[model samples]
Target: MIRIVIVDDHPVVRDGLRGMFDGDDRFTVLGEAGDGREALAVTEAVTPDVILMDLRMPVLDGVSTIRELRSRGSSARVLVLTTYDTDSDVLPAIKAGATGYLLKDTPREDLFRAVLAAHRGESVLSPAVAGRLMGQLRSPAKEPLSHREIEVLTLIARGCTNRETAGRLFISEATVKTHLLHAYAKLGVRDRASAVATAIEQGLIRRD
Candidate 1:
């Protein structure tokens, strides 16, 4: 049986996932966590083969958790199971070393298959997420913003000034300006406000 851990903020979601895994003969749920920080502790103790990680949570978010897991040299494969499939959500999770991305609405059998694939170290993505990735891959001319560019834009969208963004991101103001300029060019916008607007419109960043 494949060992697993479920991490999500909602108790209902956690219970549902735990029940699903419990009913499966091929899988065994080792633990569950209410949020990313708790997940880190639980996962360290149990050392599951696969982790079902939700993207948004209190204490720590999924992307940051994934990065921390990688940094700590955890061997568990992370399968992101969340409601979000936007570019901002998907790209960051994948970049932070998620093994798969599956929407919460995925059919039961498909989610099972995805978990198996993830345990085998295979890449799994829901159809919507896959399509988004393929579109980015095929759109060479349109050029998706780099991760740092997206980060700058996200902070800007949150109403942070250039100096504030730099301080928060631990980069120089000049570097922040440089990232914004590159983002403006890629987004076909000439200013911070327009770049933020375009990025939000394109789903490259969320307004909230």
Candidate 2:
């Protein structure tokens, strides 16, 4: 049997998932967590074969938790079972080491098959997710902002001035200004306000 741990903030969702998996002979529900922090604790204690993770939660989000799990050398494969399938949500989770991505709307049998595939170290993607990834590949790729540029914009969004941002980043104000200019050019915005707004809209930065 494939040992599993369910990680979702909603108790109702967790209970429903547990009920579904409990009846299956091929799988066993090891435990459940309401958020990513709890997920870490539960996974460590149970050492389950697969983790069913939700993206958005109260304490820590799924992608960050997955990264933490990898950093700690846990070999449990993570299968994303969330309602979101946007590029921002999907790309980061996959990059952070999720074995599969499945929307909450997936059929019960399909979800079971996905869990099995994930346990076997196979990459799984829902049809909509696959199509979105393909569409992104076929479209004209916009110049992505660099890490420094994003940092600068994120600080600016948080109401940091150039000097303040530079001080926080341990750089000169001129360097911060340069990063901002680059970010503006890449985002096709003319000013700081517009750049921040555009970045937030494009999911490049979190909205404060």
Candidate 3:
């Protein structure tokens, strides 16, 4: 079973998610928090395998909370559940280390699947977000990217094969593909095009 903490400012939302998870055999909601600071404290106290985080809590908000947790070396995989759909809101959460982004309206089963995937370090982003992010990465930057990621995205944008990005980056093709997946998750995009666009927008990589 996957142990999880649910953090949202709404008691109703928390109750609903708890009810849903309580009915599942593979997951159990272990704790609940209505604010970001409480979420952090509860998570640190219990150290669950996953956190279902709401975006707009009063004290810290979802993005900063995730960043704080990650900065403090907490390994709980964060899966964001919020009503926000804009790229600006979602992308910041992703960049702050959320493993997934989901609308509050997500079906219970699908939300469960996303949570499970996040426990395994996979991400969930809407297709439209994926597109806009890639489109945005086609700009200039200041943040540092791994040499390997640079090689991969540059090649990907140029239409290089995964095998080709791998060859040029001097890593296994599988490794190149894996890095792209992480990059995409971190960039809050889905494919190479969106990854490139969002990376540029987020300063994870460069542009002319």
Candidate 3, poorest ten consecutive residues by summed lDDT: 139-148
Pitting candidate 2 against candidate 3, the one with the higher lDDT is 2
Mark the regions of model 3 whose C-alpha exceeds 4 Å error after superposition: 135-208
lDDT, candidate 1, 107-199, per-residue tens: 999999999999999999999999999987897777779999999999988889999999999999999999998998999889888998879
Ranking of all candidate structures by their TM-score, best first:
2, 1, 3
Q: How do the residues 28-142 of candidate 2 rate in per-residue lDDT, one tens digit apiece?
A: 9999999999999999999999999999998999999999999999999999999988788898999999999999999999999999999999999999988988987898878
In angstroms, give how far residue 131 of model 1 lies from its true place: 0.3
lDDT of 1 at 25: 99
Q: Which stretches of candidate 1 lie over 4 Å from their true place?
A: 141-198, 201-208
For candidate 3, report its TM-score.
Answer: 0.64
For candidate 3, the lDDT comes to 0.84
lDDT comparing candidate 2 with the true structure: 0.94
Q: List the candidate numbers ranked by lDDT, top first.
A: 2, 1, 3
Please tell me which predicted candidate would have the highest lDDT against the true structure.
Answer: 2
lDDT per residue as tens, model 3, 1-208: 9999999999999999999998999998889999999998999899999999999889879999999999999999998889876656777898899998888888887888888899988877655566666766875543456777876887887778998877777789889888898787666678888898876655455565
